[model samples]
Target: METDSDVELAVRPAPHPWLVLREHAHLVPMISLGGALGALGRWGLAQAMPHPAGAWAWATLWTNLGGAFLLGLLMSCVLTVWAHTRYVRPLLGVGVLGGFTTFSTAELDTRGLVAAGHPGEALAYVATSVALGLVAIMLGLGLGSALLRRGRPRRVTP
Candidate 1:
């Protein structure tokens, strides 16, 4: 006999690349706009706070952590009630936040730090970035979920 999990698996449609792309076609432009804005913002910030190779890069750390938090908050709110809207996720989460958080830059920073004879700092920076980023995201998610739940009306059963 098929188990409940098996039944659910059978009932669910398997993901197809073409179908996924078609479904999200409308989001392309929204994501593109958000990405452009996000990248520009990051570039502006980096310009404002230029750091040498192998030094502590505060701007990037802040940007990534901030982006993670915002992404979490946006996702929480969207998943809770605004999930029906297609624009929000693509515009904010996939486009803005994704573009804002640069793993490539992070890798470059770490590599530079190591190459600059600051392996200890490089290790610390990487560890702290990942750990704090996760914490920030969770915190934002919790706060957003709580706020949304508070605004929702409680159900009454007779």
Candidate 2:
């Protein structure tokens, strides 16, 4: 039994992936620019604080932690302050922070430490990075919320 609703559903065309991409094509430039700048900043940090193969990768550690904090802060601002602004998330969150943070490099650093017969150091590094990254995000979110509250004008009713 082919009802009118069933016929309409069967005749409806599925959206092409290309059309979906085209709809948000305008964000490409912002994301690309942000990503480039983030990568450059990460590279500069690495250059400034280069470590040996088996040593703690301070540069990568700081970069990841910083990126995580910034992401949390940015999300808070986006939700509370810039809720209506388009492209901020795609540019800063998806692009800049995405480019700045390097999980692959972190994994490689851990592997290097393990290969150099420092399993304990590797474990400690991983644990410390995860713990500190989480703490950093929480701090960032709290700071962002506090700043927003401070900036707002309070209403007084007597």
Q: Which stretches of candidate 2 lie over 4 Å from their true place?
A: 1-19
Candidate 2 C-alpha lDDT tens digits along 1-158: 75686445546677898997799899989889889888888899999999999999999999999998998899899998999999899999988998898778899999999999999999998998899999989988999999999999999999
For all the candidates, what are their Cα RMSDs to the real structure?
Answer: 3.6, 4.5
The global C-alpha lDDT for each of the candidates, from Candidate 1 onward, is 0.88, 0.91
Instruction: State the lDDT of candidate 1 residue by residue for 1-158, as single tens digits.
Output: 75676445546768998999898788889999999889988888788888987899888998899998998899799987887986888898888888888867988999999999999999999999999999999989998999998999999999
The TM-score that candidate 2 achieves is: 0.85
Worst 10 residues of 1 by lDDT: 2-11
TM-score of each: 0.84, 0.85
Lowest-sum lDDT 10-residue window in model 2: 2-11
Q: Which pairs of residues collide in candidate 1?
A: none
